[model samples]
Target: MRLSAYFMPTLKENPAEAQIVSHRLMLRSGMIRQQAAGIYAWLPLGYRVLRKIEQIVREEQDAAGAQEILMPTVQPAELWQRSGRYDDYGKEMLRFKDRHEREMLFGPTAEEMVTDICREIRSYRDLPKILYNIQWKFRDEVRPRFGVMRGREFLMKDAYSFDLDKDGARRSYEAMFRAYMRTYARLGMTAIPVKADTGPIGGDMSHEFHILAETGESAIFFDQELEEKSRAGELTVDSMNQYYAAAEEKHDADKCPVPAERLRTMRGIEVGHIFYFGTKYSEPMGAVVQGPNGETIAAEMGSYGIGVSRLVGAIIEASHDERGIIWPEAVAPFKLGLINLKSGDAACDSACEDIYRTLSEQGVEVLYDDRNERAGVKFADMDLIGLPWQLVIGPKGLAAGVVELKNRKSGEKQEVSLEAALARLTA
Candidate 1:
């Protein structure tokens, strides 16, 4: 991709409406545009990050034995009625009517719809199954704020699992819990899973995965060991949930005596949540399977959800620097930004072209700066976009058969032979 032809409309100053750091940075970097009070049109750069996060979530869910499926964003009110939640869901549920004046609603969540689907396939052989979808959900937020972090309409990756009995349901929940830990670890984050209330879902067991950030809405308290695991890899389910962690609502002062120094108190964003609800929806919707004794029983059920679009804002809140977003390599829009320090200068242009071709041949995603902008502007844009590597090809460095490689995270720069830089990057 070439910057000259790209549609990155960066701003010179922060938007006054953006109150939080993540919200401000997202606007300044031209990642998204506001369409309405709590809605946004994701720009190209923002869409890329959203898709990356969704793909990671899908991969982890698949690895945990969940099957993927697509459900409608708009559902009949009868589905909710069957679950006995049509009126209890509160104002957040956006209800409407179709052309025929039939009561319908934009789905805030898919519990009822999924339950209806499972009831159709009920049988002993189909006793257990996991179904998932990555789609947009609509919620009439009373007051949406903080950019995509709290939007009226956003993308969500939700999954539902069915099992023959209570024990099987617990096992399924554990598998998803493990998968969430792995997903967060791969994104260079620590999602502290804390016990939580089931709320309207009516479940005996529920957990919320919160990513600690200074600008988050929910205050969080966790043990000191969690900080060490923040950077450590190989996080198993036991290791991830070994220490005490909870949101402010769940904090118990008497039982958990985390020393002042050992306790990490910070605002945290809720990125993912898992709940094991035994027969909550199945019983109401008649999602029963026949047993060996020829008797029917409601299937135990669980649901897991990841706020796919909100993660983009949450990640920026947790990981970005003063300059702009510092995307994890696994989710960065482009791996490298090739900056031609003297764009249009024959020598610098030639060197940049050669390097861009080499990287492209290696199947690397590189953004080539072919625009005739000043060197300082180009440098700033590269930092704002937050590519992992910045290959600087100035005429002065090219004359010496060397180019400068700068690390986005460490801010370290080194002058090396062109061949050596390529080897280091490709390796």
Candidate 2:
């Protein structure tokens, strides 16, 4: 994408209402624009990042043997009523009446709707199946603040599993558990798995994935060794859950087995959650399958959710510096930022154009800054957007037969011949 033609409306000053680092940086970087309290319109740049995150979530879900299927955003209230949560879900659910005065609601969660779908499976052969979707969800927060972190409208990835019995359900849960760990690892974040209470969903097992950050909302107490292992990519669901990890709110000091010296405490942001809510929705909604002997039984079930839109803010909360967001390579909107330092100069322009073309042709996503902007302005904008690698081409560098390459994360620069730069970037 060419920055000159792109619709990135970066702000020189932070928006007045943004309280958190992610919210402020997102606004200043031209990623999202707030339309109302806790509601936002994802501009093009923001949308690109959102899609990238969603795709990663999708891939991991699929790898765990979950199939993709988009459920409706607006579902019949009757399903919730059958699950006995229509009224118990509280005002956070956007309840309403349709044209003919029938009850309807914008789904805050899809347990009820997914259970109704499982009603189609009539035999034990369909015992194990997982369905998932990445879609927009809404919940009317009483105090929706912190930009997309607590937004009224947001995108989410929710997946549900149906199994023959408790044992089968446990296996399904484990698959998702490992997948979640792999997902966070690929996103360039160390997400610790913390034990959690299954609130309205009513489950015997649950875990919330939290990314540690200084400005995070929840306080966490965990095994210091596990924290290090998670950062070093040495953790699997089985090994991670063996260690003690919990939010401070749910933690008991006396019950903790880890020695005080081995415990590490920090603030964290919740980005994903998984629950095994056996028979909660299925039993109530009559999602039954027939046994070989012809007995009907409610399928054991579980639900997993990842905050797709919230991760946009959560990522910034976890990864950023004074200048702006420092996107992890996996979720970065573009891989490289190619700057034509002197746009109109023939040598510089040709070199940048050739490099940009070569990178693009090599399946790399590059954002070329070919605008007639000052050096400082171009550098600032490039740093603000936070692409992983930046290739700077200027008249001086081209005259010397080299281009300047900078690693955004380390702030390290090197001048190399055009071929060398291209080879390094592609390699």
Candidate 3:
């Protein structure tokens, strides 16, 4: 995308309301704008990143054998009532009434709705079905803070599994748990599975995927070894769950074998969660399947969720540098940044255009900075947006048949032939 035509509304100063670095950078970088207390308008740049994250989540879910199906944001209150959670869900649930004097609500989660769908398609033949969606959800937070980290209205990717029995539910839950690990790992995040409170979901097993960050909510005590290795890549449902990882509430000091010296304690942000709620929703809503002997049984079910939009903010919190976000290649909006350092210089402009064209032809996502701006301003904006690789062209470099190659993470610089730079970037 050309920066000249792009609608990135970057700000020079930080907003007072933004409390954390990610929040501030998101505002200053023109990624998001607050429309209300915790609701945001994802601007062009931010929307691109959000879509990229959502796509990665979708790919992983599909790979794990889950079917994609979008659910409604607004649901009938009758579904929540059948699940016995209308009043139990408390103020966080955004309850409302339609103009016809009928009860309605913006769904905070989709357990009830999904269960109802399963009941409508009842049969043992369709014993195990996995359905998922990427949609918006609303929770009326009493004190909305920290930008998208704890927003009132946010985008989320939630998947639900309906199975014939407890054993089938366990398998479905494990599949999602494994997929979650891969999803975060692709984003260059080390997410530890911590036991979490199931609350109104009412489940025997629940786990929260927490990304360790200095500015996290719950304190974490975990195995020191997990920090060294990449858990996200080398994980699956078959792996033993005997690891010592838990949130503060579930942490048992005596049972944990990590010596005090090797133990690592830090705060973390919960990015994903999975829970196995045996017959909670199915039984309540009559989501039943028949056995071979003709006996009807409530479907065992599980729900898995990844905060899709929140990940854009969480990723910044985990991997940002002094300038701005250092996006992982898998989730970066663009792979290469082409800067016409001397936009007015005919030679430099021609070289940048050629390189940009070559990269584009090679199927590379390049953000060409063609605006008439100072070299410093161009470089700063390039780093601030954190494209993986930046190719800088100037009159001096173009005259010598070379352009500068910059690695955003290490701040490494090299002057190479235009052909070599193209090879390196497109490689």
Candidate 4:
């Protein structure tokens, strides 16, 4: 993509309303715009990043044996009523009436709806399965701030699992637990899975995956070794639970297992959650299957959720520097920023064009700056957008048959021949 034709409306100054680094950087980089309090219209650049994260989540979910099926954003309120949660759920539920005067509500979660679907299946053969969706969800937050991090309407990857018994449900939960660890790692982050209360979702078994960041909202106490082990894919639900990791509400220092010296306190932003709510919705909603003995039994269920849109902001919070966001290559909107130092110069433009075409042909996503703008403006914008690599092409560099390549994260630069740069990047 060429910056000359792009629609990134970057701002030179931070928006006063942005209170967090992710929020401020998102606005300054022109990734999103506020459409309402606690709501946003994801701009092109931001939308691409969101899609990238969503795709990664989708891939990981599929890898864990979960099938993807999109659910409706506007679910019938009657489903909640049948599940006995209609009146209990508070103002956060966006309840309303349609033109026909029928009761309706935007779904905050899909437990009831998914249960209704599972009710259609009959035998134990269909017992253990997982279904998920990536869709927009709305919650009427009383105070929606921090841009997409706490937005009222955001994209989410929510999955529901069904099993014949509690043991199968446990296995399903563990599968998702491991998948979440893998998903976070692929997105260039290491997340700590901590035991948690089910809250209004009403489950005795639950875990929250929190990404540690200085600006995170939840205060956490955890053993340092679990984080390192998480990266090596050596964590299971049982093994992880044996370690000491909990959010402030659940952390009991007196009962802590690790010695005070080994216990580390840090702030973390929650990015994913998994729950094993045995028969919570199935029993109420009649989501049952026939047992081998021909007896009707409620299927055990679990729900897993990943904050697809919030991850964009959370990643920025964890990875950005003073200049701007330093995007992880796996999730960056574009892999490389091709800056033509002298946009109108024949040699500079030709070199950038050649490199851009080569990278494009190699299945690389490159954003080429072909605009007639000052070099400083281009540089600032590129840094603000936070492409992983920047390819600098100038008349001087072109004359020497080399392009200056810079790694955004390391701030390291090297002048290499055009072919060498291409080889390194493609490799």
Candidate 1 local lDDT, residue 383: 89
TM-score quality measure for candidate 4: 0.98
In the range 180-264, model 4's lDDT, one tens digit per residue, is 9999999998799988889989889999999888889989889988877877878999898678888898788788899877888
Residue 366, candidate 2: C-alpha displacement in angstroms: 0.9
lDDT of 3 by residue, 22-88 (tens): 8998998888999999999999888989999998999999998999998899999999999899989
Residue 307, candidate 1: C-alpha displacement in angstroms? 0.3
* Candidate lDDT values, in order: 0.87, 0.90, 0.86, 0.91
Model 2: residue 71 alpha-carbon error in angstroms: 1.1
Off by over 4 Å in 4: none
Q: In model 1, which residue pairs have backbone atoms overlapping below 3 Å? A: none
Ranking by lDDT: 4, 2, 1, 3
Whichever of 1 and 4 has more TM-score, that candidate is: 4
Q: Residue 345 of model 1: what lDDT?
A: 91
Q: Which number leads on TM-score?
A: 4
TM-score list, all predictions = 0.96, 0.97, 0.96, 0.98
Is 1 or 4 the stronger prediction by lDDT?
4
384 Cα displacement, candidate 2 (Å): 0.8
Clashes of 4: 0
lDDT of 1 by residue, 160-276 (tens): 989999888888888888888888888877777777888888898888888878778888889878756654644444565577788888788787868878988888899998899
